[model samples]
Structures are given as C-alpha cells and as structure tokens.
Target chain A: MTAAALEAARVWLVVALTLLGLFFSFVSMVGVLRLPDLYSRAHTASQADTLGAGFGLAAVALTVGLAGAGFKSVLLLFFIFVTNPTAAHAIARAAFEEGIVPWTNGDERR
Target chain B: MADADPPPGDGASADGPVDSAETSGPSAEASDADATSGPTTSGPTTSGPTTSGPTATAGAIIVPVEPTSTLRSTIAHVAEAAANDGAPALHLVEIASWRDGDPESDERAAAAERVLERVAAWATADLDDSEAPAAADVEVVTAVIGADDYLFGADDYVRVLAEYAEENAADRVVLDPEYTPVGNTTLLQPLEFALSNTSLSVETAPVDRPTRRERFRTEATTGRFVALFGLSLAFYLLLGDPTYWFDAVTGVATAAVVSITLSRVSLDSTPAIPRTPMRIARGLVYVPVLLYEILKANLVVARVILDPRLPIEPTLNRMRVIVGSGLPLMTLANSITLTPGTLTVRARDSDLYVHSLVPWAREGLFDGSLERWTRFVYYGRRSARLPTPRERDDVAILQGDDATEELPIAAADGGAVGAGDESDGGDETDAAESIDDEVTDR
Candidate 1:
C-alpha cells in the first residue's frame, strides 16, 4: 500500500481505539457509583478501570509511536490487569470476614 | 445538747452495745451519742431541722439512731422501722478495743485506718445533700482496738457493717469501699462475696478516668511503620538490583510515611513490635547445624553401604529433647534423618520417633548426656537444665502418645521389611529379643 493510505489507516485505528477506551472509561465511572455495594463496585472498578486505562494507554502509545513509552505503558497495563482484581478480591474477602453486611435498597439508611 | 439524753439503759438490747470489751474506754455508742449531741452541724440525719419538716411530712423521718442496746430484736426493729420510713442513715461509731499485742493487729489497724480515710472522703463527695437529700443518712465512726484485744476476724467486718445498717434503720451501709486492706489481708474475696449475697445495696466509688497525658503517652509511637519500611528495604536490596532497589525503597518509604501520617492524624498509634533477637539467633544457628547434619548423614549412609554384611537392626525408638519452639522440633527431625542409622518416623510436641539401623544408635536414644548436650546447643544453658530420660519419657507418654501410636501402625501398613528380614524366623526372634533388651535398659 502507499504511505499516505497506510498513514490514513493508522490514524483511523487510533481514533477508533480512543473512542472505545472513552466508552469503557465512562462505563467504569458509572458502575462505580451505580453498583449496589462495595463488592460489586470493586468488581466494576477492577475490571473496567484496568481494561479502559490499558486501552487508552495503548491508543496513546500508538498515536505517539514512541517505542520506550509504548513498552512502559504496556508493562503498566499488564501490572494493572494482574494486580487490580487480586487486590479487590482480597479487600472484599476481608470485609466479608469482618461481618460487613451489604445494604439492600429497602433497608438503606435515610 | 439540752439534757444529756440519758443513755438507753438496756445493755442487752439488740444491736449489742458496740463492743466495749477491750479498752474499757468510751464505747462507739457513747462516742456517736456525743458526736450527734455535740452541737456540730454535721449530723447526717439532722443537718437542719428546717429541711426535716418536708422530709418528715413525706414519710417518717428515719434518723440514724445510736446503738442503744445489745439485743438482736432491737436492731431488727430499728431496721424495719427505718425501711418503713423510706429513709435510712448510716451511723459512724468509734469503739476502742484491745486484742493481744501482736504486730499483725497493728498492721491491720493501720490498713483499716487508710480504708476509713478513703471511706470518709467518698461519703463526703458521694452523699452531697443537693443530689438526693431524701436518701439514707451516712455517719462514719472510728474504732481503736487495744494491743491485747482483737475486735473480730477481718471476715466479720462486712457482717458488722450490714448489722450496723440494720440497727441504724438504713437500707444501705455507707462506708468507704476501699478493698485494699481486705485484699492485703486476703479477705477481700470473701467480703465481696458476702456483700453480693446480702439484700442491702452496696456501692463503691467510681475510679477516675485516665488523664490526657496518659492517653497521649499511650499513642505516640511510629516504630512499627519504621520497622516495616526497614524490613521491606532490606528484602528489596537483598533480592533486587539498583533500579529495582530504588523503586522498592521509594514505594516502601512512601507507604510508611503515609501510614505514619494517617495514624497521627487519626490519633491511632501503632503498637510496639517485640524484639526477637534470640529467635533470630536460633534460626541463624539452626540453619547451619541442619546443613552439617545433612552432610554427616550422607557420610554415614555411605559407610553403611560399603559394609558387605550390612549389620543392621532396624528398630523404632523414642528420644526426648527439651525444645520449646516448633522450629527446633523441625530442626531435630531433619537432623535425625540426615544421620545414616536413623530416620525420624514421627515427631510431635517434644518426643521423636526414630527408626534406627544399628543397636548402638538405639542405645544413644536413652543417653541423658546426649540429650543434655542437645539442650545446651539448642537452648542456652541459662534457660533451664536438661530434663532426665525418665522425665522425658513421662512427658512423652503424656503428650506424644497419639503420635507414637501412629508409628507402629505405619510400619505395619508399609510392610517394607529392612535388610535383616532375609533370615525370616530367626531375624524376627532376634529383633524381638533386641527390643526387649532396649526396653529393660530404659
């Protein structure tokens, strides 16, 4: 393919990935506030935060085309993907063990 | 006082005249009458005649009457009358009596004096008329005993107080409840038990709350955060290169500072971390000993292999060692297996079950000198003297029996006969005889 066409395809891919990342990021914030309790909120934060932040970082790295920064960004994403869920699970388990019962809608404190 | 109110003439009247048996001095009754009749404004019942009118109109005025006679009936009547009037007063009377001139009596008197002072302070503070003027009256009396005379056993003090309450037409005995004197004399428990069982109410002065400085002193340490940071830094440096070390150090420092600052802000102080230098030293020493034992066992196994006839008598024997920690028990077991002639079949608490290949090795199990040396090496000699084999065996039988029982069953189930199994019946007889000999030796 010609250089101009290749450049156009790369730019389109970056734009598409950025929009996808923005969507996930919005979903993560919404889930954080809207989820019923801490456990569910934790699940949303761990999964959506890791994935959205990872995709956004990847898109930014692709758009900039800086090798070292891209590599570091990927490493950060890997770290978040691995650690976030484990930490969230540990916190939820500890809260459960300590007898923190979840609140239901009807029973919410006014 | 108008006319010296003639002393109630019945000496045997209930409430028995406060013991005048010792000093032949003025009795508590006489002293109380003097104190009450003295124009002092401190009389608990008649603080003011003006206030008494409203209180009397509400109910019969339950004046704290002085003990008049030595009759149980009179005391009961007074108590019942006071209860009916809904006002009761404590009467403090001083009785001077003498027990024998023992120094213990003086000590007890001194202790009782301290208790009385505390009671007096409590009464002054606790019974402020502003709070509950209609409640029972409280009067305090001091009594002195002669050197040759004993008042009553300390155990009877509570009973005496209760009886005094009844005689004074009081619902509760109001004395300083300082229990230190009773505790020092080992009489507090019985006194408290007796008081708890009684119908009349008993109350103690509230303990003062801790001061601000005390709370501050309890909460001013950040040692744990510092130690945790130090540990993490040390671990990072030992395991990582320069960049990793730098990252770890920064992360740990940040965490420590954040934690310490949060604790300060929240007023939640960290607890002191116990120093375990001896335990660290033990772990350091044991790691090397275990390595050496592993090497030595390798040599012994090699030696056993070279001997063609393979003179081996496999037997299970128990060894006792004085070890307090679980780590040492693990060390001992691993050390045994590292040696050629023995393998640790079971270990629990302080007892070890070792299967030995040679009879001499079995003999070594019962040797007290070896056990003592093991103790000296593992635990410092200053800690405790090594226990004898008999003591070891007794402890083992008591605590290690369950672990020991598992060994024979394991051996039976595995059915992996040793090299000596070649001679069949002869080997079995010999093995049995050897075990019998070992038991008799013990």
Candidate 2:
C-alpha cells in the first residue's frame, strides 16, 4: 500500500480499537451496577475491564508504532491480562469466605 | 489462593477429625486457632459451647457435614457434649444448593445422601465408643436442606441451617475446623458470625489443624533454581536496557536474590528443556482461543446486563477436571474466571465450583470446550480429545446439596475419583488411565 493509505489504515485501526475499548468499559460499568452480587460483579470487573483495557492498550501501542513506548504499552497490557482475573478471583473468594451467597434468579438484588 | 493443592490437603486434613482428636489439646489447639482467629473466638464467646464444663445441655447439636479431617473430631466432641446433655438429638445437616427440578438434582441428592450416610455412621460409631454408653442412643438425624432455594452467601447458609436447627430444637452448632462449604475459602468465620445472630450458639470444634506452612512446597531443586534464575534475569533485562553495564549488574543481583529466595515456591515444577519451550509455544496458541472466548462471552454477558429483562440464572456447578494440579489447575481455574458469565468459586481437589450467570454460560461450561483446551495445553492432543465432563459423569450442579461429586469420605481415604480414578472404574476407561500415564510421563 502507499504511505498515505498505510497511515490512514493505521489511524482507522487505532480509532476502531479505542472505540471498542470504550464500548466494553461502558458495558463493564453497566454490568457492575446491574449484576446482583459480588461473584457476578466480578465477571464484568475482571473480564470486561481487562478486555476494555486490552483494546485500549492495543490502540495506544499501534498509534505509538512499535517503538519503546509501544513495547511498554504491550507489557502493560500483558500485566493487566494476568492480574485482572486474579484480582476478581481474590475479591469473589473473599466474599465467598465471608459467607456471602451468590445471587440467583429468585433472590432479591443486593 | 492461586494454587490448587491447598484445598484437597485442607479437605483431607479437615475430613479426618478422628486423627485431629489424638493431636488435640488446649495449648496446641489454642495457638493454632489463634493463627486463624475467627472461628475459635465466635464459638466460645456465645453460650460457651466448648468452655464452662460438660453439662452445657445442648438440646440438639447441628453439625454441618463436610469431609474435613477435623470432622471426625468435631463429631466426637459433639457426641461427648451430647452424652453430657443426656440424649440430646444430634442433627447432621448438609446444606445443598439446588432447585426442585434440576436434571442433575437426583445425582446431586444421591451425592449428598452418601456424605450424610458416611458422617452418620461415623457419629454412631463415635457414640458407641463414648464413655457414656447411654449416649449410644443419641438420635442421629441427617437431612439435606436448601433443596428448593438458591443459596449464595453466609446469610443464606445461616438462614437455612437456622431454620433446620429451629425445627430440630437445636441450640448448638458445631462446625468442623475446616468447614469451607465453598472449597478452601474458609467460611467458618462468616458462618459463625451469621449463625451467632440466630438463637443457636456457634462453635468451631477445637481440633488440631495442619499448619499453613505444611501445605506449601519447601524443597528447592537445582532445576527449579536454574529455571527461575534464567526467567528472572530475562525479565530484569527486558525491563532495563540489555546493553547497559549498570542494568546487567543490577539485573543479575536481583535475579540471584529472587532465585535464591523463591526458587522452591514459585514455579509449580522443574522446567524440562524442550518440553517447557514446547508447552510455552502451545500455551501461546491457547491465547487466541482464550481471547476469542473472552470476546464472545463478554458480548453475551454485556447484552444480558444491558437488556431490560436482565436474563441471568446464576447457578453454581461442579466439574471434576483432570488437568493435573498446581500450575495447570490454576491456569484452568483462572481461565474459567477470566471468561465472562462463569466464575470459578472454588477449586477443591479435582472439582471446580463454577458460578454460571446465564443458561448460555452454564451450557458453555458443561460443554467443556475450555476444559478440553486446558487438557490440550497441559496434557496434549490425545488427552484433550477425551470425553467431555458431562460424558465422563464428572460434572454436577452443586446448587442444592454440598455437591461433593464423590463423597468426601472416599476423598479422605485417598481414593477421591479424579483424573485417573473415574467413578465408573471399569471396561473402556483404561484408555483414560493410559492417557493419565501419558500426562504424568511429562
């Protein structure tokens, strides 16, 4: 592809990934609010949040174009991917240990 | 918490309350309980179940049944107390999480029955052996409660047990020291606290608990040390400039310190040369599959959350996995949690207690796609192609009964059917055994 075409494609890729990131983050927020208990809340807090962060980081990394900062962003993405679910697990486990029953269909929203 | 071995060890130790009795005493029990701090205090602060002499008169002692080593001792302790009270009814209750009409309800109920049966037999045996032969008549009533309800937290458990205790006119509740209904996550504190709010006095049976240190790997291998040193050095250099003399010096120093301190504990096992690199490459292949799953499930969960109707079923199910233990199990558990709509609530022995948000998610979990992938990652293609959890009869809905897929009694005997030991135990399953051998061969 030509230089102008390549640059345009890169910009579009960044925009799309950033938008996707924002969308997932918005969903995570809604999920945390709407989901009934700690266990369910963690589903969004970990998975949704990590995906959101992941897409956002990917966009940033692409925009920076494979240099030092880009590598750092990728590393940050890796850390978030590894740590996010673990944090959620710890929180859910704490809640479980505390004797907080998970909310099911019939139970009142907490 | 990330490790998979603690639960089984904890469960195994907790299940043998009989052994705990021999090891039990005021000094040993006190210091040990002090480390945990919650369950021990909650018990004695109330109507003084373990303190203030033997004639405390427990009208009915409700003991939540789990397969902990402390359970045998807890039963013996309760039986002794019951004997002192002169024929107080001993209620053995297993809190189940099931709706009235789940397809697996019968299987779940049968599992609960087996646990109760074993515990009741132990209780009867203990009573028979008691100094007070008159206490041999101690009525042992076992029932599975929470059958119709969705029990999620300590309050729910307390609510059900309180209702059961009230029905039986039980005044005291004796819990096994390691009575973590939801696997290794210790629920004793919250259960005790919640139960304290009720009329029934709560007490964690003063049994000898295995020290937390014993649960961890302590032996440092040369292979593990070298592997950790190499990885640490790589990580350090990656963060800093590889060409810088300062960075190289500091990196080596840091790597040495890390390897020296954590070589034994960090990695699950010693890294084999070509095998480790091969596994890493295969593991890299798994990332796309995992990411795809995450993306798809995220959309589904997001849609459900966004929908006005808010369609969510939120069921806890159990699946016995054969991804071996330690790092492999941690990988599977974390992957399950990372996938939206399903959260791994606990990992006790080979069983994963997963909470599924919707029917779609629950169905996905039962499908064992991720589990199969996990096996493929850890054990290889042949192991991955084995029967799905549903097909293998290793999956169950733990909602109603304390979903011990196999009885904890069997688990305590070191015969908990997992990986190699399929419950069916005959015929074509030699295929599974040979595969298990293949996995261990690594």
Candidate 3:
C-alpha cells in the first residue's frame, strides 16, 4: 500500500507478465512448428500467439498507466483478440469449402 | 462435458456438435468389437448419416442487437464477418428484456418486434452480397429473445439470447455493446456479461467513436496534443538559447499546427478505442489472464512437441456452445487451438468442431473449466461447464487394421469379401496394404 512497496509490486508484476507472455509465444512457436495439420497449427498461432502478445502489451500498459504509449498497447491487444482467430477461421472455412478433407486417424474418408 | 454425447456421432467418435439423429450405430459393425472399439466410425455404413446430416450452422449466421449509434457498423461488419464459405443465411436477433408477468411488457415486446423487422430489412439492404450465405436464398430471419422462455427469471436475458442462437443454429453472434439500457449501466451489465459468457463467438460491433483529435477537447484526447505542445516549448527553453522566448513562440505555433492536422482525420478505423478509464482498466486485467492461459497452453504444446515418442491420439470434440456471442466463442476457439495438441477444424451453430491431438487433450476440451473462465472474465458470471462425456471404448487403429501390411493375406480375404469384382478387390487390398505399410514404417 505504501509508495515504495506499490512501485516494487508493479515492477515485479510487469516482469512476470512479460516473462509469461514470452513463454507463451515460445510455446505457440512450438505449436505452429510441431502440430500435425493446418488446423492444429492455426490453434497454436491464433490462440497462443494472441495470448503472448496480449501479455506483453498488458505489461506495457501497467508500466505506463494511461500515457499515450499505454493506450496504444491496449488498442493493439484488442485488435489481436478480434482478428487473429477470425482470420484463422476464414482460412479453415475456405479450406473446408474447397474440399480439403480434414486429416483423421485410419480410414476416415472411406 | 459432451452434452448429448450420442451413442456414436461421426466417423470420428469425437466430432462436432452431436445431433442425436446423426449417431451412426450399425455402421461400425465390421465386428461388434470394431463397432465398440471404433466408437466414432460415423458410418451406418461407409457413408454415414452423420456426414450427410445438416450441420448446425450450415444454414444461418445470427446477430443479436439493440438500438444504438453503432447499429450501422454492426450490420456492415456482421454481413462481411459471418460471410464464411457457403454463405449462410442471416438471422437478426433482438432480445426483449421485459419481465413477462406485466401486460405492458407484452406491448413493449410487440413494439420491439416491429422495430426488429425494420432493423433486419435495413441490414439486409446494406448487404452487398446477399449470396454471402448462398445464392438465391438470401433471407433475413429475425427473432425476439424473451425472458419467459427460460424457467428462470428475466435476469436470464443473456441465457435466452444464447438459447435462441443455438435453437436457430446460427453460426455467429454479432452485436453492438453500446446498449446501456436508457443509460442505466446495471441493466446493460447482465447483457454484456451474458454475451461474453455464451460459448458461441460474440463479436462486439465496432463503433467509430472519434479519437482525441476528433473529439475536440475530451480528457482522453487532450493529454496527447498538450504533451506535444508542452514538449516542444520545453525543448526550446532547455537549449539555453538567449532568444528563448522567440524560440518558444515558434515551437508553440509549430506544435499547434501539427496537432490540428493530426487530430482532423482521427483514428476512427483503428479497432474500437477504449475511451473510458474503466474500459482501459478492465482490458488491462483481461489481457494478463489471456496471457496466463497462453503461457499454460504453450507449456502444454511444448511438452507434446518435445516428447520423444510423439504421443498424439487425434480425436474430434463436438462442443455444444454455451455462449452465443462471437467474441467469447472465438476467444474460446482460439484458446483451444492455441493449447498444445488441439485444433478447431470447423465452427457451426451450437457446436465447435475441434480436432485434439491426444485423448488427454480431447478430455481437456470436454472439461468445461476453460469455458467457465471465459464467461467469468468476459461477462462476470460462471455457468455450469461442459457436460460429462459418455463412457466410450478408446478408439485407435486396431492391429487388424495394421495387419493389412500382410498384402497377400488381405488380398485373398478381399477377394472372398467382394466376390464379383476380383480386380477391384485386388486393387483395394493393395491400397490398404500400402497405407498400412507406410503408417507402420513411419
């Protein structure tokens, strides 16, 4: 509650958030790199990456409060949350419409 | 939980939203064990009823609404956004929030219904591509969600919207969040909460509120322009110039001109800006939680990727959407996709078609805790999570399926099975054997 402690808490929180965001970003990289199909990779890229970017921005917001830079960061987060999965959905739906059959175990197509 | 976990759903046991009529029981009857083991064979025969059944969101894309300045943008965005392939029909929804016991509420409902019809027509006219859902079938289906539909009270207005979206089998929920009922934030709170809480993707219609430069002298916009002018003058004086006063005047003038030019056009197009301090603060809170989920999800994915054995058992999870709003639905879908070893293959009304890498991952999808968190964060409420999945025999490629690698044995067996077409049997057997060999070797 004191100024010193509050500042310290804020600093620590920012670090934690940034680190967590980076870790998720790395995980999303692995997901995109490792997952089997287009759909799976999309999940990693859209969800994981959005989270990573969101965290990083949140940390930035905390550090800056209502400054010009902080406001912009929140705006960026909103865009990612809105558009990331949406673009992925569009791609997937397009693929589905094009008759690119989903990959399944064994003789699913049969 | 796999609500309405049908006895068997698709060729894959774990598939999209389960329509009880589509559960193919007799198709996996290659043997009783095959039927039981290959629980999701999707076949009543090779071509199953499930595959042929009408998809939940195949026909319509739903948007819920209220009267607001953002109405135009909602129409434009929803028309364009839900334009998923196949160009589904549009269902415009407006929930009547009146507590049903009073007769006055019914009069209000009737008036609201008339307004809804006009809104629907106006939105349809705005659509440049009526064929977005399909050519020659462009119809605007409008509905009024009422409180009395639920066994609960009017507070369940959110639930009613969700139920309507599901019942109509509409693909998405698009709405403007500007509905603060007659400026009473409390009444609007539940609706916003419900929109976020619903499992369906909820997209808040973006409103083009003028930015700082555009808003003239609003507090949110004032800081930036002032800082520019202030900094310019401060820099002039700090340089220790003897003619500091003259330099300061020039700096002030320059800053004023720059601010005027920049503020004129405004950033109306930049994804909805948070004007209220409260909104910015809430966003700050929400982003961190999203990041935590991302971090946890990444760790999961990392484990899946690093494992030497490459432990992955792919299955589809057919999810019954609890939330009807597009933003929450999408967030949940993106989360699932982001999580290690799971991907959303298809999205439809009331069902999210996810393909998870392992059985564990598939189970995680059904756990419902994720959906609960989403609702809590977005809407400030927690509903019952996923339904418990039915007990199923774990499905995998059987040793018999693999035994096709013994080419000659399979061919001989195929010849006996398909007695008339000797060559067709031989070719089919050869293809199966080759596929088996390739899989076994991999």
Give one clash count per candidate, in the order shown.
Answer: 24, 26, 28
Tens digits of per-residue lDDT, candidate 2, B172-231, equal: 888888886644356789888888878887788877775332312233267788999999
Predicted structure with the largest DockQ when compared to the true one: 2
Q: How much is B72 displaced in model 1, in angstroms?
A: 43
Worst 10-residue lDDT window for candidate 3 chain B reads B390-399
- Alpha-carbon local distance difference test for all models: 0.41, 0.68, 0.51
| Most accurate candidate by lDDT | 2
- Model 1 over residues B222-305: C-alpha lDDT tens digits? 554555555556544443443665777676776576556554343222333332444456555654554354334333433333
Q: Candidate 1 regions off by >4 Å?
A: A1-110, B1-229, B242-275, B282-291, B338-340, B360-379, B388-442
Winner by DockQ between candidate 2 and candidate 1: 2
The reply for model 2, stretches above 4 Å from the true place, is B1-220, B400-442
TM-score of predicted chain A against the true chain A, for each candidate: 0.81, 0.94, 0.84
Output the worst ten-in-a-row residue range by lDDT, candidate 1 chain B: B395-404
Q: Write the per-residue lDDT of candidate 3 for residues B177-289, one digit (tens) a residue.
A: 55533222324555555567567665566656331122213543465555455555564454435265786677677668766665423322112233234334644666666
Candidate 1 lDDT for residue A89:
44
TM-score of every prediction relative to native: 0.29, 0.54, 0.39
The parts of candidate 3 lying over 4 Å away from their true place are A1-27, A51-71, A105-110, B1-289, B325-342, B373-442
